[model samples]
Target chain A: MPTQRDGTPVSVLARQLRILDTFDAGTVFLSLSEIAERSGLPMTTTHRLVAELVEERMLERLPDRSYQLGLRLWELAARTPRAMGLREIAAPMVQFVQGQVRQHTQLGVEGGYDVVYLDRASAPNAVVNATIVGGRISLGASAIGHVLLSDKPRAFLAKIVEAGIRRYTDKTPQTLDELVDVVDRVRELGYSVADGFIHPAARGMAAPIYGPDGRVLAGLGMVVPSGEPVNMRIVELLRSAARRVSQQMRAAYIDPDHPHALPGAKFRVLINSSKSSMEYFEGNEGG
Target chain B: MPTQRDGTPVSVLARQLRILDTFDAGTVFLSLSEIAERSGLPMTTTHRLVAELVEERMLERLPDRSYQLGLRLWELAARTPRAMGLREIAAPMVQFVQGQVRQHTQLGVEGGYDVVYLDRASAPNAVVNATIVGGRISLGASAIGHVLLSDKPRAFLAKIVEAGIRRYTDKTPQTLDELVDVVDRVRELGYSVADGFIHPAARGMAAPIYGPDGRVLAGLGMVVPSGEPVNMRIVELLRSAARRVSQQMRAAYIDPDHPHALPGAKFRVLINSSKSSMEYFEGNEGG
Candidate 1:
């Protein structure tokens, strides 16, 4: 159980949230007992909280009395600028990339130690893509993850390195030095190319999308079939798309009162210079 | 504050939900005072709850110290069978309709007294559509709403009538008789054609999509320019698309252990016959 700074037990709100956290991509439905066990709460407390959650429509009781996450949560999340706002603005660009490449194109934001996908567009028979909307990939194992973490502080990077990276494939970075090298390359090139890092059958390339504050807000990428030469044309397409999305984010955040402006303390305006990668991309793209 | 049947005040979960409910599309950001005011909670209670919420990432604290619904909520909502599950299965059909019609095509399910859109595909220059994914339209006002309400019990329909419908345009249903007529027409025709009901410049048409239980689960629809003559070809395409989606739902629900089967008390196995609307559509489509 979670405790406060004073060593007191957490509030009912914390326990309720613990219940919600139990549901994920694989575990969508759970009986009361399952929720109780997964949440590590007493059965009576779980029952009381579950009753209140159902009454509030945060959780829906199914036909067989199993519980699932409810629509009310989605309804509330729709108003979240971080997820849906970024998605609405970046969707057209993501769609364009998918249309041009006929592969799996996606946008994802940094969520803790994972890269959480916000939107994805896939062709009917596109190359294998394990990612889905609202799904997560480890921040150390994917091209998009490299781009999202490119702007983080050295201390943060060291912390991630200390935690250790999972080995998904032979090409995935397994050491701190290799991970740091990848992050530095992404910062220098304004994009990342991961060849068969997640899976041997696929290659992923991504570029950083900037917010109005000029920080790396998200990563836009495409997953194409491996066994072929890397496509620089696709990399350029992704960079151009990311630039367009970044321009929109700038416009959206110019009005500080605009509800779509995502709030983050680490956000900073990107400076334009010969050395700045964003400026370098704009020069090459003639934008 | 909401109370239980025994007149006891609702749980902290309910109050926390009340805080969440204060957010909407227009009211995405809320200051501590604003949340307290909107949620009708004491300032101290609101502060404590807000602190806990931000700590849990249920609400994100912005740079300016205002709060917006957080990505955690979206992550949780992504596991909802009613929203994301239905959306994932129905997306391809929705895309097909949108591609064929070059207009706004969408899928929606009944939520309380409204039809909540789950997914939408729109051409770049499609006719104006007021709906967005996770947005709502009243049951008496739109074609999608008509089809979604077609399977509900009479007492529920009467309750909706008692609440009265908002008239968005002169063509919208003005009385209980007109609303009932619209529902009946949707039932008989296996689709709905709503002309200028929501606005003068847009026309919406829809057909019901069924769940594995054979009950009306959602509505798939298109919005196009209002002045053109009703297109029978579009209606036929919509009915066919709905049928395909229903078949997928049937396949999905065949396994009792599947996580995507939505739970609802009113859901029933749809029977087939000459007079059944679903059967009639299948026959017309030669399926």
Candidate 2:
């Protein structure tokens, strides 16, 4: 494998991507020297790559000469089917859930070992929500993650357990046994309830959303104030919202007249139901 | 300059970016051959780049073996201060405007020669809106652009005119003279009112949002059904929302307690008002 001046066994493209990856939620702006330090690239190489990235408009320079990720990345990412596509189809349902729940409503999809949020709708002065759009939460730490992981195989759950879960709170699952128990409950009940899994003052609940092929595609969930008796009405509402999103997803894939219908593809007419195939849920999650 | 097998003068990073850029709004999914054809790269080069991109999780392979822009791009773009940052700050004001106008409310920032929409809020069953988040509109064609350009220099408008504006409708500004007239009106009124500029059935109105430095940061606007008499009350609502967004933006930069306050930075306090400096608007729009 070829390497840049850093000898990191990375391709030129990977090196460029590495530079971009240096900017995250906390470190949105950085000087070239800070970028060199964070990316571990020599100043000359970082300077060159940063200049090319600026020219390509992937990284923009601030007025103070600091650098940040540019709008070009957002422009490209806006076309992503996994994020924006599902969000567009699920927005109305999420809004419905948010309006009824009067808290935070979110949609998340599986990304590696975490559930990445696709969209979120929150009421003013809602309960504490740590999730942001395009943000991620560990699979063993939230109800949304339980819904996403409910369809995964035992081996996948074992691997996540072996990798070690971050204990967000004492209520978070700490072992494969705990994870499997929660996932099984989600699969059997068609919904999940995680009270104080992340924060002691908030509760999380979610239901699995399915794609056109009857495979689990994402999770629709909410965060509300904890300490109250579990509201079965809200749980039913969440499941209904998830079902609506699933129905919309299926219609988009099966109905040729749908605006989001696949251009030249065929799919099975999946019915939006709480039941899905659990034995064959170990497939790749498509965008 | 190093060239690929297709004899393009693009560097490796540029080639990779070009491949990502091929997936746009209309073309989200593509096969390997389709990507090769669209990117104008040789099949082998396209294959190698696509494989690398998949490994990097920049492009995801769909279940049909086609490819789409991946969630990782969205993940990275989520960290961009220009798009998501501004969108987060301007969201509430946009929502307020949407509530009052009962139409498609939007916030846009200047990108290159176009105005890129950062965020939008629409009521259910609202009038037709062609703009999307992270989408772009020509700077000379809409009321939002007029507010953004109200502070721009005559030479900048001339350059846009020389580039040959696309006539979306007969009501769109066709020459430098017409563009200047509308922009001058916007400058005088602290708001813009464009009737049937983009679509013959809709009208556009916007006001300028200012930054901490008193520079025009964005345009807060709304799209409504045309053919009705202009409602100055709605125009006042739009200006108020823009002012609220500007005040929030200014507060975020100046208040040390603000969650989004810049660390280790100081600047002159800026007051948010309808009036702003118009003589010095010709400068780089920073992220």
- C-alpha lDDT of all candidate models, in order: 0.76, 0.77
Model 2 stretches astray by more than 4 angstroms: A1-9, A92-102, A121-128, A254-287, B1-7, B92-102, B121-128, B254-287
Residue B10 lDDT, candidate 1, scale 0-100: 73
Which residue pairs collide, candidate 2?
none
lDDT of 1 by residue, B131-212 (tens): 7567787888989999988998767777777887778788888777888888898889889989889868789999989987
Clash number for each model: 0, 0
Model 2 chain A: weakest 10-residue lDDT segment is: A273-282
Q: Which ten residues in a row are the worst by lDDT in model 1 chain A?
A: A266-275
TM-scores of the candidates are: 0.83, 0.85
